[model samples]
Target: RSYPTTTDEEDPDSNLNATCPEYFRWIHEDLRPWAYTGITLDMVERAKATANFRLVVLNGTAYLEQYQKAFQTRDVFTLWGILQLLRKYPGKLPDLDLMFDCVDWPVIKSIDYGGPNATTPPPLFRYCKDNETLDIVFPDWSFWGWPEIRVKSWVPLLNDLMEGNQRMGWDEREPHAYWKGNPEVAETRQDLLKCNVSDQQDWGARVFAQDWKKESKAGYKTSNLADQCVHRFKIYVEGSAWSVSEKYILACDSVTLLVQPRYFDFFTRSLKPLQHYWPIKPNDKCRSIKHAVDWGNTHQQE
Candidate 1:
């Protein structure tokens, strides 16, 4: 929330020298081109301080200290991703200042269904929870779509799969509603599994329960992202809070049968109902899913 301005007396060249424009461009050029504005040595320091505070408060001082050490060594996954991008771009990295006036860090107010207290304080930045408050909004990190941080385990794989699906085209895909993920994360996932009986018995959806522990033992090769896209419909159910799988599900050419989500990610508000996805009511999940699957199956060409 603090917006401090750089003093005019400060040497512009010194500020420029302190910034790694190559690093900035590498991390943000493709995802956020506008991030290159107003970036300075001072801004970077401020952002770092804010980020460190957030980490310390939320993830404990040890985590914050670890990140600080990583930043110092330039050996963190986020920094590594930036370095890779810089290497990929080589001389093409831009010299623009992309740091923003305000930091857009994400904060979660509450994950439960009852909703957050009305008297809750303003979020430090964008907030995520079951419902949106004044300063609380933006979906969870699963849908944040920032690949540089390596925050979530599935992100890098999901990113590659989405890109691969884009290249493969939609004509080759089938018409079944497909969903694959661990069902143990939430009761909603268990409800989703209930709808996956027989085509005649329930929703004609194909739901596969993914045991991550077993999958990890098998090196995760069994779960193919491109293969999941073969279906024309994909179901997105929230696990505990808001599911990160929502982004991946929507990224596919397949229409997403989104179960009424309790939480929203940073980009969820931008998506319109019946436009980007078909909403399935949580109370009538089975019936709603069946209806959506039937509708999507009938209107495949649309």
Candidate 2:
């Protein structure tokens, strides 16, 4: 398989077209070689290889044009782009494993990805018929149909447990951030919101996040800014996570938010949900995923 840099023309064999910093933080450093550092046409061509199996990290559809600031945002064409590669190259791999955290159907439709009737793809299910294995992983948009996509969605409180552990370490009672991803975000935020630290001296002591990667292209323009923010004051995460797989990186980085019963599950071995971010309620069942507030109720339990 050929791995081309930026020089190669756009094709299925290419990868690393765009990346976010969190992409690197979650996995072990040793797997770096497995990643295609940049997007190139040759990389897509490489995907055509008839291997026993092919693991597609992202949708391989080719972009008609170049994407800028790929690190901080999402471009709809990504998933279809990868699928285009698979169809064009026809990998020797018998079965392909595709992973998605949420059911982003709009993106799928944007790529013209479904239906045996459509001109582009012959319905992902039909395309996989020839292959030995066809694996698809994502939260089932609905609880009905497609067994692989089925998931038992739950809100877990784990980060709080980890912070408690950290506290114990200081007291010579528990492990020191033994839960390396132990959180400070929830604990800190709740403290300020509840205590209403009316102290004017501590006003700027709280921040959201730094825009170090705001406009940069390289490695999502990584900076110590986020970490720097954590060091300076209490931080708040303003949005909901894009994917389930992405939580590990956010939790691993800092303990910016304060804690709660819901966020407490963040330490669960089975769930280990993301750290206390914007909203405090994890167990608060959402009326709809889309309508779900990022997070609310900064007041902590006494």
Candidate 3:
């Protein structure tokens, strides 16, 4: 478990802190003959080899907005999720690429938005032109299109919300939450509506509604869950689950999503909805989400 140490007795922590800036400045600053030492042909070869799992990191809200699951824009914490995956598979994954929409670039790089802090554009995106290049399929990254009304971060707090719902005398014994995609989008919204939810109380639990469609730029009312007496979520997401990635947004929030695990690999997490991995259809030519998750997780544990 231990790594080899250098006998040079300089304080490792302080030395690293002191030298890293110099090293970075030397690499980034101009007027250097050998500035490209870190990058080489072997790295390129390795990166190409890793292209099988192309990792596309978004610079900010804009890149994700393209897919229609605007929920991806809210929090910066999701970046750590990518780092965790990379740590799990160091060499197997292609080098992470950074990309942002042409419009958001200025705002992201602007000084007012903590231009120098982590919010600033990631350097890797600048170097690597390939981003949002991963072909993997993933949907339902969260419960609702909106992260704010989605799953509470802490598990205990989540239980509280559920308990509160129960205390309100709304089917405390068997409570159910429903997650629906865009009314217009296919594979998610339309199919979500297909699932029968007519009964007020189905399977002994009260049925709740979840929508993942986003509010139009023209502005739309937030989730009407507050107005409703029932305990449900207001997820405003729309578009193709495979194409738009709203389904994975639902999965990210520990919501019990309803979907035929079509493209779950790219966003599979601990808390996911109904998974229909392989056998995606009667003519299913799909792989098992459980298998892929296990495979990825096995490598991570190893």
- Say which candidate scores most in lDDT: 1
lDDT of candidate 2 over 70-152, digit per residue (tens): 22112222343344345555432234343222212112122342365643311121111101212122222211212122222
Ranking by lDDT: 1, 3, 2
- Please provide TM-scores, in order, for all candidate models, with all chains considered together: 0.57, 0.26, 0.31
For residues 42-64, could you state the per-residue lDDT of candidate 1 as single tens digits? 53343343332222211111122
TM-score top scorer: 1
Candidate 3 structure, TM-score to reference: 0.31
* Alpha-carbon RMSD of each model: 11.5, 17.1, 16.2
Ranking by TM-score: 1, 3, 2
Worst 10 residues of 1 by lDDT: 54-63
- Write model 3 residue lDDT over 1-302, tens digit each, in one string: 12222234443345434544322332333112113344444533333322212235332211221222223443233433444444444343444343222111111122322333522122212111111222212222232133454433334434554544454443222233334334564444444343333554222112224343354432445443322224222122233323233333332332222334332222332222334221212121112222332343344322
The deviation in Å at residue 109 for candidate 2 is 13
- Local error of candidate 1 at 254, Å? 0.2
